[model samples]
Target: MFKTAKKLFTSLKFNYFSLFIISLVAIGLFSFMYDSVKQETYELHEFKISPKTIRSLKTIEDTVKTEQEKRRIENEVTPFYQFDEEVSKTRQAIAASLFDFIIEEKKANIPDPENPDKLVKSRSEQIEEVRNKFKKLEKEEPGLRLTDEAIASLLTAEVSDLTKMKQEIVSIIGEELSKPVRSEDLSAVRYEVERKLRSSEAVPPAELQTMITLGRSLVVETETINKELTDKRIEEEKNAVEPTRILQGQVIVREGQFIDSEIYRQLELTGLLTNQSSYKPMIGLILYVLFVSAIIYLHFATWRTDNYQKKKSLLIAIAVFFILVIIMKLLSLIDKEFDVQVAFLFPTALAPLLVKLLLNERLAYMMTIVTAATAGIMLLEGFSAIMQMEIALYILFGGVISIYLLGNNGRRSNILRTSLVVSVSNILFVAFYLQMTQSTYDLSELSFYLIAAFASGILSGALTIGLMPFFESFFGILSDMRLIELSNPNHPLLKKVLTETPGTYHHSVMVANLADAACESVGANGLLARVGSYYHDIGKTVRPNFFIENQHGNLNPHDELPPEKSRDIIIAHATDGAELLTKHKMPREIIDIARQHHGTSFLKFFFVKAKELGQDVIEDDFRYPGPKPQTKEIAIISIADSVEAAVRTIKEPTPDKIAKLVNSIITSKLNDGQFDECELSMKELRKVERVICETLNGFYHSRIEYPE
Candidate 1:
């Protein structure tokens, strides 16, 4: 009655949605109690500049730009102004000019009151009034005074013409000034000197107007250039800083520094915060909420991960998930205190094991993604890049162990072996990764880590083993052990099949051996193949005498019946097997194997024999309703079926005769379209033939003793 109730409840009303909502709420409530006001915070708004600061920066940019344009203009028309280099040249030119001045005048014998080198040097620096500087005479210094006798003593008849010399110097200056500045050359000048010149200019309004005109043009062109540069700079700044804000600013988080609704309302009223541009912790809040939502999504999502149940298995997933994330979070907070590396080894090894236990090996592999995400975030947060490799190796180690241990069968010994392998695998992986990354790890610490990996494997295996019974009972999983138990001769159904249809039961055993041998030869699941063979004819137990094999030669019932009725009776076993397997909670794959064993092939000999005996015949009526043999095991069983029945028909068989019969039967099965769906290669078929021949010879051996 409890079984009926369980079945009824499972079949009628399993509310997955309600279960998901409840699971999430429970997880959330539990997590909320432990979660503090502060969690992991990502800074997005903190780097943001205020509007006033932005405007000040714009003003500064304009001033700098205007200064740059004036400088460019100064440099453009003249193409001859720089900082220290120009000053150095000015000093050298003044020295050279003084030598020229002395040579031209021949005033070496006479003691000049002033050194013309100092005068010319000072005058050359008069960038604002170069014309006026040379026209002035200094009276402030006593050094400028000269006696008439002394001035006359400086004169010489060998004097060069000062007028001609001055003319030559002026010509050189004109020649230098006549050269036009290239556009690119004018755009390169020191900004400070130009600013100083602009501030100190005294007269020459016309010259100032011309300079202003040039400055305006340069300002227009440079404004465009500066704007391009500013845009580019903004992009470069964005690229360098790499601004990213996630979660779409839509979700409301229950944790962290959230702006109170009351505070936001007041700020909105005062226009201190706008809806779009206001910094209200929205980005960070939404991102946290998204992270939380994704956690819930991964936990509650009804993903059909192979054998795992959605409604019941969610809680285990949620527990493991939070344990991983929370451990990561806690480790991040206290890493320095604990002296842990970027990530601890426990979680990486634990993730795949947990997935393998609660779900499938495929999902166990899928755990690598979550681990990678976890490692990626840690790397971004400041862990060594080497942590990623360690995490990857740990994930792969766990996956390999889980797949090797839990892929086909979950046994305690396999689990132990898996633990051993995981221990060794983790140690090897760590060794290689550390050597490559040049990490310093103590051997004692590594041994402890491997022990932890081994323990995790055992724990995951235990969990999987413990939970499997419930899932198999609940979701009707047909494990090989269950099938094997069901196929025992003592089973109620098998016993019924044996006593009620002894001939069919005997036939099924032979079929099981043949099918198992065929499957093993081709590297298929031999156990499933064997179990499927036993139950493939369970329907024969329903109506034993209807089948020829179970009739025990009691004046053939089909002899009096129409060919259609007889063929129906024969073809009915396949359909009957399907219904029984389904009703008894066998897996769909086994049901398919049973249903497709016969395929849509005609009952050739029986139909032809009936027709030759003068009965009206329809070819379609004699055919078995089928989906055909979809798997190698089923197709192999079909060929074995024909072989066993045909071999049984041979009244007196010898070893040599049996070999010929077995080869003939296999050839007929191949030619009769029985081998099409199996993907059976020629090599495998030959192997099957050899085994069947050997088995058949042993079963029918009667050798002469004189030969030996």
Candidate 2:
């Protein structure tokens, strides 16, 4: 029944149709991921504010509030300050110049008492001349003069007191103007100078008042605001505000709560508010599925395997992919309905494990990529985009690690060990991801992730162990596990051969060794060839005395029988072994090896006997029935079987004799057209010959004769 099913699956037409159906199912499922049902719409008046506060359902940026808060923080920032050294120095210089002009004018206006002819100007005229000079200086340089009160006070001062006041006022003004002064603080600075001067008794009361007035006018504003610095400070503060995060399953709008503009926008961002424009998401999803399906098709089309095996592999890949997708979707639904983190416990490595065991490792890695991508899309609900991406990467890394640990061929114990490696990889990936995202390291949450990682590995191993036999039996696949099981010495057929015909059993073991080496040399399934060679002679168990290998003490049961009967007995083992293997439900490849190893070659020994006896016998009457070897492994086994039997006939085999015998046997088999059905190349055949010759020569090498 499985044979018929396998044949149907491997057929060209069925492969194409199945691929199409799988692609369609994938497209439908991916599209359903984003197909949102129309949400219930309510009018503004229908909304009522609830007494209890409501929270956001999804993590969405509140653009309106975020921008508003940023702007408010920016407005509250104080402007920057810039020191104006040039302005301060200019003000000090102008004050010093005004003092110098006053002192010089006081000296110049002194009456010339020594000379009666010299006309002396009146004090008022001199004061008027000094005031005109000050006015001219003010017109030359703006912001250089004192106030009206300060000028009036300086003009009425005594000459000696005025000169002393000029030095004191200029020194005080320079000291005050040296510091940064804002426009708003100018009056306060002036008052501070007046108070300082009033407390000083070094100058007369009139001079002190004049010094205070001049100091007030000299204290001009020098500091200005720096807009660039203020703006930079505001930007840094705005960036420091934590982005609002709405936990998964949080309530966006509670029952009977008013749907404000903010709530409405949240609903829209979360995909809860649907409109006619929603079909765009579905269209995008379909395109994505189509692209992935194309990749799958290209991988299968380019795979370097037989057409039948390619179809079988494709079917298995599609089945595994859909199984993973279904599991992911179910887990997502559970997470959504129960608000649990079951999705984290998903065994993403399960698909890769199955592929690695039942198929090739390359296919396993490829399927892992496809499964991870599909899972990321399917489990996007209730997860932030970043979380979904992390989950996908986590799945990819886990699958890769599992495949790497499984290696070329895995055993049951290897599966357990691989699980441990996968678990460690998963834990490391999760830890790295959390650390990179800067999430709070809650011990409970971390423990949960650790548990999930361990569970993923254990579950992957369990699922692979449980599903491997079914795939092997259903698909007629001879996986390495199955071959290993068959290669055990305690297998029923192998044990039967061991007990009933020890010599033939020994011969089969030798053939297995030879076939294994030869097949390995040519890059064939060496394990399968070894296992197949073990049971290739099981039919000899039925009549151990009829074959030469089981003939002990020179006893030959075929001597009493006719030549034709002896030939019948010899050839019957091939067909009889095939029947027994089939009855025991052995793999077809092993049965074919037992059936076709001889490949209808003429039994020349018996035929020569009949011809020497003057009896007319046809060549066809003494040939073994055969369908010929059908694969590289089977072909190698067939050649190795004949080579082992031929080498055993040499009583004292030498290296040159063994080489000649091996070469002659291979040449005869080639001329007999035994390997026409298989894909064994001429180059591979030469390598097989060399390896078999080397192994046999070493096995049957001359030993040192011991003195008895």
lDDT of 2 by residue, 1-708 (tens): 977965665575645764775677666666555532212323322244644434433466666667777778788877788888887677667767786777776667665789754546655666677678789767866655565555556655666776666566666667777788898988888887788678765567866756765667667778888878977877889898766555556787776678777676666555554351345455767777777777877787777667766777777877777778778877877776643356667786898999878778888888898788777766665535423776788789999989888875667788878878888888888778778978576777778878987888888888788778988887777788899999888888888999899999999999999999999888787888899999999989878889888888977877787788899889999999999999998887788889988887879999998898799989988878787777888888888888888888898998889889988988888888888988989899899989998999889888999999
lDDT of 1 by residue, 1-708 (tens): 998955654464234543545556545533432222122222223223322311000011223334445444434432222222232333234423432444434433344358633333322222223223212321221122322322222222224333333333333323332333233534432232234225533313333332232222221111113345555554444344322221112222223444555323322333233333433333443454456445645644556332225544544445555565665566455655544343434434455555564455555555545554544343222323213456645655565655655555544455556655665665666566657867677877666555655554555455545555555565555555456566677877677778888888888888888777767877766777787877788877767888878766477887887666777777888899889888877776678777888887778867887788798877877878877676777877777777787788777787777778878877876787767766787788888888776766666677676954
Global lDDT for candidate 2?
A: 0.77
Candidate 2 residue-wise lDDT at 427: 82
Extract clashing residue pairs from model 2.
none
Report lDDT per candidate: 0.54, 0.77
Clashes of each: 2, 0
As a TM-score, model 1 comes out at 0.53
Report lDDT (Cα) of residue 643, candidate 1. Answer: 75
lDDT of 1: 0.54
